[model samples]
Target chain A: MRRLGAALWFAVHTAGQNFRRNLGVSLAGVFTMGLILFLVGGALLFTHSVDSVLQAQQAKASRIKIYLSDSASLASIMDFQLRLKNDPRVISVTFENKDQAAREAAQNPDIQAALNALGSNPLPASLNLNVRQLTDLGQFDSMARNTPIVDKTTATDYNPDVIGKLRTVISVISLVGGIIALILLVISLVIIMNTIRTAVYARRTEIEIMKLVGATDWFVRWPFILEGVIGGLLAAVFSGGIVFLGYKLFVQAAQRSLLSVPFDASYSAALLFLLVLGGVAVGAFGSYLGVRRFLSV
Target chain B: MSVALAERPIMSPAPALRPVISFHGVTKVYPNGTTALRDVNLAVHQGDFCFLVGASGAGKSTLVRLLIREETASTGRIFIDGHEITRMPHRKLPKLRRKFGIVFQDYKLLNTRTVAQNVAFALQVTRPGQRHLREKVEEVLWIVGLEDKLDKYPDELSGGEQQRVAIARALVHRPRIFLADEPTGNLDPDTSWGIVQLLLQINHRGTTVLMATHNREVVDLVRRRVIAIEDGRVIRDEAQGSYLREGEATI
Candidate 1:
C-alpha cells in the first residue's frame, strides 16, 4: 500500500512538473494531435455516411418479375409458381392472372381505353417472385431458368447492377478512409515525438543532474511521459468536442431539414461512440508513440 | 580478480564503532573499457569528515559513484551499513540515494525553477506534502544564508550564490550521508572557504561528509580527514587539524 501510494504520488508530481514547465510545447503538441485526429475522424464520418446508402441497397436486394406471354396457360404459370416456391432461393411467389392484370390496368384511365379496344385481354398471366437477399438474386435467377414452366424471369424490385456499383463505391470509400486514418495517426505520433524531444533537449542538463543524484530511469522518464499524456488529453478533448458538435449539426440539418430518407435512423448513438473512440484512440496513440520514441522506462 | 584485489591497496586499520561505508575490493570498468577503480578497499566511519584528493583520472569520482550506487562495482562488492551496495539494482538506488545528499560541481540547478523550487525538488520528488516541502525548503535556504533569494532563478544568481543554493538543495532532505564531488572546483578562493566552512559545520552535526576536491588551499583551511589518491590508488590518508594554517595553504 505504501509503495502504491509512493508510485502514484511520484507520477502526480511528475505530471504537475511537466505541465508547469513545458506548457507551451505541450499545448502545441495537443493542437497538432487534435488536427490529426480530426482529419481521421472526418474521413470516418464521410465513409460511414456514404456507406449507409450501399448498406440499404444490399439489404433489400431481391424480388422477381414474370414476363407476360399472351399464349401461356394459367395452369402452366401456376405450376411454375409452385416450382419457385419449392426452390430454397425463393421466399414467396404470387401469380397475377390476365383478368387481375386487366382490372389493375383499368385503374389507369390512360391505359383503360386502349385495353377496351382489344377483342380479348392481350396481356398474359404472370407470377411475381421475391427472394430473401439481394446477393441471392444470382442464385434465384439461375434457379428460375431451370424451372421448366418459367419462360423468362425479371427482377422488378431490386437492381443487382446498381447494388454491385454501390458496393464498389463504398469499398473504395472504406479503403480510402482506412489509408487516411493511418496517415493522420502517423502525423499525430510524429508531432508528439518532436514535442517531447524538444522538452528533453531543453532539460538535458537538469536530467543529467537528476542522474547524478541517483534518479532512476523511471524518474528521468516521468516528466517526458507526463508531457505526452497532457498533450494527448487536450487533443482528446478538442477532437471529441468537434466531432460531437459536427455530428449534432449534421443530424439536425441533414436528417430533419435537408436530406431525410437516408438518415431516418438515429445516428446520435453512432456519433457518440465515434467521438469518444476517436478521442481516446488519438490520445492513447499519441502518448504511446511519443513515449516510445523519447523514454526508456 | 582476487589476486589483483590482494595486490592493490585501499584497506586501512579502521576503528569499528560504526561504519557508514565499507568497500571490499570494489572496481569499476566502464563500458568504453576504462578501469576507474582497481580494487578499492576503504571504510568511512560515521561522522567522519573525509576528503578524497586526487589529480584528474585518479578514481575519486568513481569511488563516490560506487558509494551512492550511481555505478555498481564491476569486480567486487561494497557495503553501506553492512548491506551490499555494489549489487544494488536501479529500482533500489533512488531510495538508497534518498538517504544521501549530493553536491555537484556544476551546481546542477534546474534553470526553469526558482531557487526555492529547486531546493524543494529533492523532497518533492520524494513526495512530501506541500506544507512540509515549503517548510523544509525555507529552513534549508536560511541555513545556507539565502532565505531572501528564494524566488531568484539560477541564472540570476552569482557563482558563489549558485553554489550555496546547490548546497541548500543537497542538505534539505537531512540525509545521513553527504557526498560532494568537487563542490569547490568552480568557486573563487573566498567563496571556496565559505563552502568548506559550511560543510564542516554540517559535519559537526553528525552527518558523514565525504568531499572530493583538487583544491589544496581549501582542504588545508578547514582541517578534516583528507584521503589522497594517485593513479587509481590511495597514497595518503591524513588528519588535517594541525598540519597546515589558513594563509599558508595555496592552490
Candidate 2:
C-alpha cells in the first residue's frame, strides 16, 4: 500500500515537473488539442442546429391542402378529415370551412380583391394535412385527387419540386457535416500523437537512465501518461468553455436574424462531455504510443 | 576530492565456486552484419574485479549490453547469479537488471536534478516507499565522496563530481554486480584513477565489478584480472594481467 502511494506520488510529481520543464512544447500540445476540440464541438453543434431548423422547415413543407367541392356536405368533409387523420403517414388533419377560407384569403389583398369581384364565397372548404414524411406528400396528394368530395378544378396544393429540393438540401448538409467531423477527428488524433511524441523525445535521456537503473516499464511510463491525461483535461475544459459560449452566441445571432435556431442546452452539455472524454482518451493513448518506442532499451 | 589509491582496503582472494556472471560461447551479430562478439566464454565470480580492455568497437560495449540484457546474444547462453538471462522474457528484464549497476562514459546524470534527487531516483523507481530515502542517498553520495554536494545540480559540478554523482546513483541500490563501460574515457588520468579507486572500494564491499576501458595505464597499474578483446574475440584471459601480455605486440 505504501509502495503504491509512493509510486503514485512519484508519477504525479514527475508529471507536474515534466509539464513545467517542457512548458513550451506542453502548451503547444494543449493549444492544438484545444483548437481541435473546439472545432469538433462547434461543428457538431452547428450540424445539430441546422438539422433542427431543416426539420422545422421540412414539417412546414410536408403539408397538403385538399380543396373540397362547394356541394360537399359538412358531415362528409368531417368524415374525410377523420379518415385522413387515421392514416399512419399523416400527423394531423384540419377542416377549414368556406367562411374560414375566405377569412384567411382576406388577409391577402389580391385574393380579397379577386373574391370581391366574384361577389360570392368562391373559396372552397379545404382539408389541411400534416404528414410524417415529405416523400409521402405525393401519395397523399394523389389520394386526395381520387376522393369524390375533393374539388376537381384545383387538386391538393402539394408542390413536388419544392419538397424534393428541401429534402436534397437537408441530406447534403448532413453529409457535409458528417464528413467534416470525421476529418477533424482524424486530424486531431494524428496531431495529438505527433505532439506527444515530441514531448517524449525531449525526455528520452531521462527514460534511458530510468531503464538503465532497473525501473519497470510501467514505472517510467506513468509520469508521461499522467502528463498526457492532465494536458488532455486542460485542453477539454478550455475548448468546451469556448464551444459553449460560441454556440450561445451563434444561436442568439441566428435568432436575431430570420432563422429560429434553438439553444439545446442538454445536447450542448452532452457534446461537451463527449469532447472532454475524447480529449483525455486521445492524450493518454498518444502518450502511451510515444513512450513505447523508447522503452525497448 | 583527491584520494590515495594505495591506501585502499585489502580484497579477498578466494573465488566463489558459482560465478555470479558467466558466458558460454556468446556471440552477437547485429542486423547490419557487424559481428560484435564471437564465441566469448568467461566467468566472473563474486567480489571479483576484472578489467575488460579492448580497442573501440572491440565488443567491450556489447559485452556490457548483453549482461544487462540491453541486447540479446545472437547465439550461446549467459547466466547472472546462476540464472540464464539470454532467453529470459522481457517482463523479467527489470528484475534481472536490478542485479547490476552500470555507468557510462558520459556520466549520464540528470542535469536537471540535484545530486540527492539523482541518486534517490533509482530507489524511487525500483523500490518505492523505501524508508529513509534521504539518508540512503546521503550514504551513497558519501561512498562516492560527494556527501556535501547533495543539493548541487550536475551542471554546477565539475566533470569529476558529475561522474561521482552518476556513481552514487548506480550504487544507491547496492547492486550485486557493477558494470562500468568506458567510465574514465572522458576524464584525465588523475580523475580516472580516483574513479577506479572508488570502483575498487565498491568491489572491496563484496560486489563484483567489471570495467570496460581503453586506458592501458590504469589497466597496467591495477594489474588485476584482464580480458583483452581483439577483433570480436577474447584473445587473452589473465588472472593477474596488464593491458598487454608479457612480451606481446600492441593489444
Candidate 3:
C-alpha cells in the first residue's frame, strides 16, 4: 500500500514537473492537437448541417403532377388518386380541379394574364404527389404515363435532370466530408505521437537513470502517460468549447442568410463528448508508444 | 588454453564460500556479430572488492552490463546470489536490479534536481513512500561528505561533487552489491583516490563492490583482487593482485 501510494505520487509529481519544465514542447503538442480537433469538429458539424439542408430541399423537390385528359371520368381520376395515395412511396395525393388549378396559376402574373386572355378555363384536373424518395419519382412518372386517365401529351412533370443533379451534389458533399474527417484524424494522431516522442527523447537521460536504479518499467512510464492525458484533456476542452461557440455563431449567420439552418443541440452535445473522449484516448495511446522504445535500455 | 593460463598468475577464490556473483562460461556476441566477452568464467564472493581492468573495448563494460542484466549473455548462465538470471523474465528485472547499486563515469545525476532530491529520487522510485526519506538522504549525503550541499544542483557542483552525489544516490537504496563502471574516470588523481576510499568504506560495511576501470594507480595502491580482460577473454585472476602481472610492465 505504501509503495503504491509512493508510486502514484511520483507519477503525478513527475508528470507535473516535466510538463512545466518542458512547457514549450507541451504547449506545442496541445495547440497542434487542439487545432486538429477544431478542424475535425467544424468539418463534421458542417457536413451534418449541409445534409439536413439537402434533405429539406429534397423533400420540397420530390413531387410529381399527373395531368388528366378532358374525356377522363371523375370517378376514374378519384380511383387513380386513391391508388397513388395507397402506394408506400407516396406521402400525399391532392386533387387540383380545373377551377383550383386556374386559381393557383393566376397567382403567377404571366399565367394570370394568359388565363384572362382565354375565353374559358382550359387547365386540366391533376393529381399532385409527394414521394418518399427521389428514385421513386421516375417510377411514379412511368406509372402515370401508362394510366388511361392521364393526359397523353403531358404525362407528369417529373424533371429527371434536376433530380439527378441534386442526387449527385448530395453524394459528392458526403464523400468529401467523410474523406476530410478521416484525414484529419489520422494526422492528429501522428502529430501527437511525434510530439510526445520529442518530449520523451528530451528526458531520455532521466529514464536511463531511473532504469539503472531499478525502477520498474511501469514506474517510469506512468509519469509520461499522465502528462499526455492531462495535455489531451486540456486540448479537448479548449477545442470543444471553441467548436461549440463557432457552431452557434455559424448557425446564427446561416439563419440570417438564405439558408435556415437550425442549431442541433443533441448532435452538438454528442460531438463534444466524442471530441473529449477521442482526445484522451489519443493522448494516452501516443504516450504509451512514445515511451515504449526507451524502456528496453 | 593451457599456455594462456601458464603465462599469467591465476588465483581462484576459496571453494567453501558460495559466490554472490558467478558466471559459468559466459559469452556475449552483439547483434552486429561482435563478440564482446568470450567464454569467460569468474566469481566474486560476498563482501569482496574486485577490480576489472581492461582496455576501452576489452569487454569490461559488457561484463558489468551482463551482471545487471542490461545485456544477456549470448551463451552461458549468470547467477546473482544463487538465482540464475539468464532466463529471468523481463518483468523481474526491477527486482533483480534492486540487488545492486550501479554508477557510471557520467554520474547520471538529474541536473534539474537538487542533491537531496536526486538522492531521494532513487528511494522514491524503488522504495516508494519509504519513511524518513529525508533522513535517509541526509545520512547518505553525509556518508559521501556532501551533507552540506543538499540543496545544490549538479551544475552548481564540481565533477567530484557531482560524482559524490551519484554515489549518495546509489547508496541511499542500500543495495547488497555495488557496481562502479569507471566511477573515477573523470576525476583528478586526488579526487579519484577520495572516491576509491569511499568505495573502500562502503565495502568495509560488508557490501560487495565490483569496479571496472583503467586506473592503474588505484588498483596497484589498493592491491585488491584484480581480474584483467584482453581480447574478450579473462587473461589473469588474482586474490590480491595489482594492475599488471608480476615482473611485467604493460597491461
Index of the highest-lDDT prediction: 3
- Highest TM-score: give the candidate number: 2
Worst 10 residues of 2 chain A by lDDT: A158-167
Runs of candidate 3 exceeding 4 Å displacement: A70-78, B1-16
Pairs with steric clashes in candidate 1: none
lDDT of 3 at B214: 95
DockQ scores for all predicted structures: 0.28, 0.67, 0.72
Interface RMSD of 2: 0.7
Q: Which TM-score does chain B of candidate 2 obtain?
A: 0.92
TM-score of chain B of each: 0.87, 0.92, 0.93
lDDT of 1 by residue, B101-157 (tens): 888888889888899989877766654444556888898999888999999999999
Candidate RMSDs in Å, in order, are 5.2, 7.1, 4.7
Q: Give Cα distance to truth, residue B180, candidate 3, Å.
A: 0.3
Chain A only, candidate 1, TM-score = 0.75
For candidate 1, give the lDDT. Answer: 0.73
- At residue B28, give the lDDT of candidate 3: 97
Fnat of all models, as shown:
0.25, 0.81, 0.88
Docking quality tier of candidate 2?
medium
